[model samples]
Target: MDGFPEKILLATDGPVSMGTATRAAVDLAERGGAELHVVHVWHTVPSPHARGFIRSGLKEIGQDKLEQQVREIVETGGTVAGAHLREGQAVEAIVDQGERIGADLVIAGSRGMGRLGRLALGSVSTGLAHRSHCPVLIVPEGEKAWPPDRVLVGHGSFEDTEQAGFLGARLARTLGVEVELVGVTSESGDAQEKLHDLDRELESRADEIGKVVGTRPRVRALVGNVPETILGLYAGDEKRALLSFGSKVLGGAGRMMVGEPLDEVLNSSRGPILISPELHPASKSRVPEREQDEGPQRPAVLLATDGSEVSLRAAGYAARLADGLDAKLFALYVVDEYLTFRSGVHYGDFIKSLSENGREATGKVRALAEEAGVECEELIVLGRPDRAILTVAEEIEADPIVLGSEGTSRIEHVLIGSVSEEVLRNANRTVLVVGGHPEYARPKGESSGVG
Candidate 1:
């Protein structure tokens, strides 16, 4: 079960902005018995008709970068299979060479703590990530990869995540490190009860990961926004190290996409990130072996609503999707706590009306789903709408979080009602934002049971 990458491609430009990539790559290669290819891509090669005057300078720059890598490899005692100096686009050269070398993974840099304000992927890394032939692990800062005592898996229910979880667990097992399944939750009432509930729910999935990696994983859930919540786990302790997850990437074979959540994680955290390819080429199937007999299982779909026609329409779309996958439909009605955040004589009335309206809206959605022959589960939680939706999705481990593209029309609500938009941006899995606008949705009178 030694599935470590035999050919590892480490892409770099110079020493300045590689963040944690170079150090992580060296240690990973040395430990996993992977042969490393340190590639420094340069666009200095002259065109067929261009002058040769600048050729020497470009070559010098490329060689200098390669020298730095050599020094790094020597220091880390890592084996270098090759030192590549390629021409043309940095991303293109890295990807092409990676494919030619039959690379199992590409290690690249992210713009951590850079001008992007700790929230942007470097342009070259972004290009390589979206266009690569294999999975790309982006480390945020320059830190040695050895002494990684813990491996964290961003757990979710997406089919793609199966590969991520199992692969990460297997790697941790091989490295003899601890594995943790971290999720973000937004449950109310009791904090201890919420954590227990999430942990209990994750037990089944943790067992699956344990079977793969040969040890059970510890499951944990924390309250907060999705990206921030997960990134917060890093905490720079340096002992609990290496974060791994599965993300869909663009291009062929994988047919999966790495969405905004991953981008945010790479930008905000300075840790080694291991991303599993969507297709799971090693296993050659999205689901595990035992489940293959059960056939292709669709991801559970979550549809958020505010009881508007627009939201109902989105629920309809979600139902159709659930029917297609033969999966359960989760109809979530979020009573936006923002409505009650302000105190006044009208506050209690607003809270009661909003909660009742939320339940009513979810009831309608259940009817819609049942009529379409899709089994539906209804849940109502009170919190900031976006964070609540994300937390509930994590609680249920919904795969694709579906919602209306817009929200209620109240000026305050609209300003605050960007819940769906925010969910679409930050959700870890596939987000189906149906329709173009919220204009045709139910009007505000519906909140007071007027409609």
Candidate 2:
């Protein structure tokens, strides 16, 4: 079962994004000798006459069309692809289907919806990517639709850099690609000497790992914002690229204290990002305690959502990280009591609606995992936002929980509801807080904060 995840699930909505996602999925499946399952989610408007009748009919029709598309693609020497269609919210239906089929991976495209549209409709891709209990691959718009051939890894701490080098070399060997080891240091006042020393140390470490892997890796050291510098390296004349990084420097304690740098890189980078958790000496000791005995399990991630645009954007970051770590992906949607209480709606109805929405999001994520040929799981829960999310994670024994920043500034984060902040402070596991609005268009000649 070492290389057995050859089943790929592709989630589509019969839109431009779906087309893009399908292309990417086919390429990956072909590369990995995987079977492809293409799924389409159709939305049906309910009428007064009968419940779900219209939806059922629409789903059959949509399924047929999607099946035709899959047949056409497969017939033309593409991947071995099959198609299925389901009724209901796009994200949920896809997730349920993936689970039913025991898909190895789910793939989906990031729909280029504008800010307002994304806010109202939410992002199926983002929601599904976060929640699916498998590796989810997201194909961004205007990017190449295939597994990366050349990889770049950003090294942070000494231990982390060593891990990054080892992981990079292994990945390079697996993918048969060259690995570029990059060490970034900020140009903060009077730190030039310190930065240089760090750079030399990182280079030496990378070289050692490269020798072990029988690959000659390139090493680079730069002084600038870590995020921006890393991005710049990849963007500069590197058409085929995949960004890799260590999950954290100091493990659980470091992630909690200093926050998640990988989250920021995932948000700001236009390309796919891979994250690997550092292995610690403590993990080598045998301990009876559940926490100590278990050690870290590649940093499994729980992605939380409210069916909001900001939360959906957080899914992108989570998906990239999940793929990098080969970690299990779980998508969660929490139904806050405030919304039901404020709307004066029946609690049952509210729960139903919320659950449906969560399922839809899960579908999108499932598609992403399928595309990437990674396994995933989806979940929906009810209760307080923070509590429900945390509870589900604990129940699942998830390692890291990834969340959106709620688009709040520092002052607003201090005053307004800070779910991410609270989770970061309280959760026993690691937390990744993504702070950026996907809908915010980047201006021409502006850098996408990669370094």
Candidate 3:
């Protein structure tokens, strides 16, 4: 019943950014009596005649070096650490290895390389995240060195909030840390009334959290936008925190979209985010079931990002979910293939940059997870956004997809945007979308759309 991974797969490309990931994998293996499977994927670029020979030779050399590095990391621990080197797409190879070995967790590192590197070399982390069956832990370079201190739990009006609360409290107890219960209330009322109501809700929730965790937490009731508010709180505070929340399914117009609050919180928060699916009322009874299932439940999460502030918030929330569920976190950075066609940038370069940015963003998410003492995996993709997200979720068997919400038009009161609308219409898994900046308070009757 220890809150630590028992068997993990450390998937790497032998990149310098993976150093932190390696350290984390070794640490977890040693601490949790876990077995470490070090997987290095050598993606040999296809080429013509003579160049193909040269490329193959170079790939072999790189593989050898990477194997040596894996050996070094394994030497640092007494646990079972084996190495697997395969040639294919990074994501595919990693996923195949993980499934073959029966790994419980998949660990990876994010590469912050610029747009060009991402284009030339697709983000393996992102791809593996989308395809891996086990929980994926993505550790950013510097963050892998720090230990988690505070845990942030995101709450909304969804049915999953209660379960999220339970999971957050359990994690805090496991890490021996304090939990911060944060709830975002839009300013749709008069200033005075909004403030009063916000205070009451914050206090009440804080009290409930205190009882759940056996300790009172410092409650924060901020009046502003939801994403901005959450980000601002973390920006102002220097404490290392892990954020947690739940993913809910939104079905409308024959489509399914993840809820918004969770999406926005995930994208904007700099700390790690833990996301869980909405638990049914029966599961909420807290009574022991007929039997306890020991196998890890598939922790499904939707990672929506566009390299924008709002999208980043979504990624942050997904990182927290990876920690909470001990599930694999998939980051879906859509290129808006339609938008890209209109953007006029060279498709190759643009796609590459987008992929690279996705990696950088994924790196940030991994950093947050490491700080929270959690493991993760990531993915990068190219296609129309809504379709791409849905396809990836199904392909990876993701149960919940986290997304960011923004108004399609300038109209206020539009809680969800076009992409979200499309996702809600089509997505099969639960979706959590986060909207409203947390910094600015909207006047009563004012529009809530991004103006």
Best by TM-score: 1
lDDT of 1: 0.68
Residues 335-450 of candidate 1: C-alpha lDDT, one tens digit per residue: 55444435342332444455567668888999999899999876655455787777667655577888876555656346434776788788888887776455545776577565
By lDDT rank, best first, the candidates go: 1, 2, 3
Residue 417 C-alpha lDDT in model 2: 40
Model 3: per-residue Cα lDDT over 398-422, one tens digit each: 7678887753234312433777888
> What is candidate 1's CA lDDT for residue 96?
90
Give one digit per residue, the lDDT tens place, for model 2 in 1-451.
1242477788765552335556767766666678888887777785888757876788777977687767756665786556787777666677778878887667776544565333222255544533454445555555463457777777763225355556556556667777888777667776779677877876787768767767757877777777666667657854667766653211111111022244345445666544444423222121234355565444567888655556666776777788888887877765453565355443334444555666776667667666666667665544456766676666556668988776334453442247776777779988887665544547779987898
Q: What is the TM-score of each candidate against the true structure?
A: 0.56, 0.53, 0.51
- The prediction achieving the highest lDDT against the true structure is 1
| Clashes (N, CA, C under 3 Å) per candidate | 9, 39, 58
- By TM-score, how accurate is candidate 3? 0.51
Question: lDDT at 439 for candidate 2?
Answer: 46
Cα lDDT computed for each candidate against the true fold: 0.68, 0.61, 0.58
